[model samples]
Target chain A: MTVFYVITKFLTFPGAITKALFEHIMCKVLKLPVEDTRCLRTDEMCGHIEHELVERPVAGFWLCFIPGLLNFLLGMSLSLFGVINVYCLGNYTGFIQNNALLSNLFASALTGNANLVSTVNFLLPILFLWLGFSMFVNMAPLPEDALMMKEQYKNLNGFLKVLFAPSYFVMRIGAPLERYGVTFILFAVIAVVLAIL
Target chain B: MDNENKNEELFDEASAIEEIEENDQPDVSVEPEQPEQEQPMEPETEQSVEDETVERLNAMGDEIDAEDLGGIPVTPPDDDSVDEETESELCVMCGEKPADKSFGEDYDLCADCRKRLVKAPISFASILFFILIIGVCFFGFLLSASQLSTLQAVSDAYDQAGSNHLYSAIKSLSSAGNIGWKTAKKAVSLYNDSGYLSGIASMVDAYFYDASASSDTKLTWADKVGKGNLNAPWNKDVKKIYSDYNTAMDAYEKYYAYFSEYDEQLYYGEIAVKDVPYDELIQKYETAKQTETESAGLAFISYCEWYLANMCEKGLETELQYMKAVQEACPDFTWLYLTKLTELQISAGEYEAAEANCKKMLQINADDYYGEYFRAMILRRQGKYDEAIAKMDAVIADYENNGFYYAYYEAGINAFLKNDIKQALSYIKVCYEGEYLNYNTANFYALLNKLDNNEEEYQAALDMISSNQAQLSPTVEKYLKKQITAEEMFNGVGNPFEQPAAESEAAE
Candidate 1:
């Protein structure tokens, strides 16, 4: 393979996208079915059994939607925290200069828990990166979900197609690349590595 | 015969269709719960009727086979549609009639645009890649941090080197230099642990080398530099600075040795003649065999001459005679020897010989100020006062005259002797206003004032001259008054340069 191939191959795994999708799959599987609760086991008990299956699992669309969104958001937030606290905030000099009040507060806190904070600060980037990439890979799309997206794509008019071209490119190319078993995971890995620097 | 062949073909086709139907049935083991539950009611369902249809098709196949064996010409089935070429498979994406190429089942691709979808390897590797990314980031961070730390160290060293504390400065500079030297030494020590760290860190080799050598040079030179004058010993900030600078040069030499790539550049790997102490060099040079230690001998002799020039304080005349003796013995061996001799000869009042040496001095250096000034002095002593004045003017004109009282004094004295009192006054005025920073210029001002007959100015001038010149011998005073000849004064007094005062304020 040439240099480009080596690079692209290394960057082949979709990280965040796949993680998000995988989480979605889990959420969907764990979710209870709500479509009119059909059951034939002992005709007299069928209604109660259907109610148990549907109501007990608490499978609302929010169950999938909330967690997936929360996971992605948390991953981003933590990575940003890692970057700011670990990378950009070097040796308290800037903080001391910029904010006397906060610096004093931080200094007092540091005096009490220097080792603890330092260790955490040191590991923040690693934890953030790991969890972030995990969520990305877990974000797998279900078959029905994919079919629904295809149906939506087919229904788009010409003007809407032009209007959504960029989004479509991202969905078709970027989303696929970052999907699990895709090179975008590797790219994300490389990017994370670079970002640390 | 054609009808019989057709019937036989129909029988074969019927059997293949039945086999396909049997294979298409759902697995009995898989989805057992769903299938078993459905099987109980299947007698009244579409499945039972489908089974009956299959039995009928089997019967028809059997009949066809019997007919085929009987050699009867059966009519071809009307259901046999007109024979037609098969329609080409169409591409799903572009709706074009595609070439016979397919990537996957149900995916007929066209020749114009065919791309196989390539999947990424390694799944759920977020944590591994994350660790790797962190490792890479930290590697870069560490490299930059190292560089930053080195720079800060060097900066700290510089700050310490500039400090007023000698011990601290010396210690810090030595440490900094050591760091530089070690860094430069390790610049090429790469055995596969290279990355951004080594790439950038290696670039500082030259910087480190330079810092190391400069530090070494300073330290070495500082070791030799003595501290403090007699009155205040070992406590001056200025002294500390000089001492630090002196020692820091050792760093320069070391760095040069360590990293300089050029072949022709000089490197002091070992201490040579210049680094040797003055006393040791003298002792070795005086006793060594000429042929065996020629280079050291030469160096020693040169250094001895320089030492003598700086230390000799007897008088300008003795200094002059010493130079002449060395010159006469060596016969212009070193250009410096001739120059010093000629200069001394002029100071000793040997005008003719000094003038003769001036010609030789000028031959060596045409624009030599020593030759020019002494030449002017010779003319003055020869009683060619106008020519002397003119030459003095020319000499002074060529050089800057900020505080050189002696040069202006010479011109003024000659002008005084020439009876051009106003011109002499002009020259003397400048020399005194220059604060006559040198003690000898007092005589010119006093004499000029006296000749002008301004008794008050003259008396003040005389008093000032008297206050400063306690070393003036009584006989030299008579000579100044023109009451005695130069020979008589020299014969009567011990040393003309000595103060004639039996008790002096300066001595007290």
Candidate 2:
């Protein structure tokens, strides 16, 4: 599990860095004693910070919740942009016989005759896809943090638990999947399929 | 995203945590060492370890509330004092801190060392890496936007040209500067193929702009565009255009090759013009009519077949019959064929039929000068010289500025037929000075000078006629050799074997 976690962090190094940055900022904001901030670790969190978090459970909850939520949203937005760029706006197979899609897009773009729209359509999606993939793979919190979150859920009132049930379930499931390198595998499969198409 | 699960058993956090709690000890069990008389411990080291433990515990206790500690039992300060005298070992994670708490009978760790076992700290390098990723994305966005704007401009330019706005399109293209293959491909996608064959035409024209481009090069480019874009999958009309274009090009190529071979044979004096393989050339273009009846290529090939028939002394009646069939089948594509057909009808003395064909030509293109010019010639042939002169005058006036020099030349012929010598010279002078001068101009100039008794000019005109010996057909060349008289040649009676009709007295 530790090797898989290390491999996951290696594969999604950008996301790992982003996770560390968010964790550090969260620690500082919550007044927790941050003992270490190294991104690549067998364990995602330090013992002192984890202990401090368990004692101040609300702070710990915020620490896990905010970064996870932001990463999830960022990943989703970037993925959507990538999809639109690949399937809707740009053409990877321009030299192929059925250059119909690009031809049609070209026609529509000319109909509007707006340079700004064409410029945007041409540039942003590729970068968005690259960044989005890393963000998506790292969206899951560390396995221990997930366990801590699950433990904290027991202390929440019925209304709050119901409100956070879906997100909590995602984080719960995503943790083990990320730890075991499942997220990277899924991303690889999807990216390969999309590229082929 | 599954992968090697070899390390799964090595780091089972849930099991390890359960084991730690069940055993009531830290990860490593501690055994207090017996003091040796030879290696006595420094008093200051033990005091500092105790002081550090006290400070760490005090700080941890101040930060977390007792109720929020959840399942973990925090050892109170009074309990720590009770166990201090009995416990003498240092911390398991960090050897510097003294053992302050015990999980099981054999295990112990300081408060700071306990937290270190669970999670690790994030680093500043990770933040710098995040910034680097963002920087790359930002720079890539700017570069792509800059490159794509140029491509977009090129696309818009091509689209403008497709719409027939060539001037503005050229302006846009020039301003966009040179484009690479990648940009060119992108620009091609943006081009609007406005269904007028404009996009394809522009490509073909640009490719064939090199004067040295061979017919095979032309054919290859044509085939590529014809099969690729013209026959594109979606549009039905475009597919049909592709089929028609390919059929026409194939037929045209065969016909052109056959004629070029025939021309070579004739030039080498190996074959007579009468043996020019008229049937073979006819066969080539005639086959194109089977699949396509309305394409410009079909129309052009039909005209070529008619010209070959006329030049080879094949039966004019046969060609006129085929032309009529073509016009019947594809009236929309028969402009050149109809024009030739009208000329043949006029020569055959079918004045009413010739006039009707002229009207049909007018319907195809309202501004067609041939329609009016032919009608005037038909009027002159019918001996309605006044009416012909008036119509020819209108044609000349309406189209003279547009370089319709043929109209003026025809008006000169009408004047000669009307016995108006002064008017004939004036109108013929326009033909003499006009850019439309060719064999017809030279022939008419000879006849005009003969009638006016200008002997010097008459000889000069005859020299002009004889000078085009290589271009003239065998039947026409006999007239230059004096085998036939000026009257016989000018009145369409040059063939010695055919008897001249009384109506042939009129000038051709």
Error of 1 at B385 (Å): 2.9
Backbone clashes under 3 angstroms, per model: 53, 24
What is the DockQ for all candidates, taken in turn? 0.02, 0.08
Which regions of candidate 2 deviate over 4 angstroms? Answer: A1-5, A33-36, A42-61, A69-132, A154-166, B1-122, B144-281, B287-508
DockQ of 2: 0.08
The numbered model that scores best in DockQ is: 2
**lDDT tens readout by residue for model 2, A7-111:** 667766667667667776777666554545556666644111233444455555677777777766656555554554353223322211123333454566544
Residue range with the least summed lDDT across 10 consecutive positions in model 1 chain B: B187-196
Could you give candidate 1's per-residue lDDT for residues B8-88 as a string of tens digits?
Answer: 544544554545456886444433234533677565545543345445767765533334445655676544334322233
Question: For each candidate, C-alpha RMSD in Å?
Answer: 21.8, 19.6
- Candidate 2 per-residue lDDT, tens place, B1-508, comes to 1112212221232344446566887755221111311145655545443335434644664433333433443333345665665545677567778775554444456667755543345555766776776665554444344445445666777676566544345446546543422232223322222222234334333321232334554443323321223222333343344344445556556555657777677666677787886776788767866775445555556656766776676676877876776566556544336777887787677889998988876654444677888888777766677787788788777652637776777777677766686787777767766676665665566556766878898778666645654222333345546686533443351232232221111112
- DockQ of model 1 vs. true complex: 0.02
| Per-model TM-score on C-alpha atoms | 0.30, 0.39
Superposed model 1: Cα runs more than 4 Å off: A1-197, B1-339, B347-368, B395-401, B466-476, B479-481, B484-498, B501-508
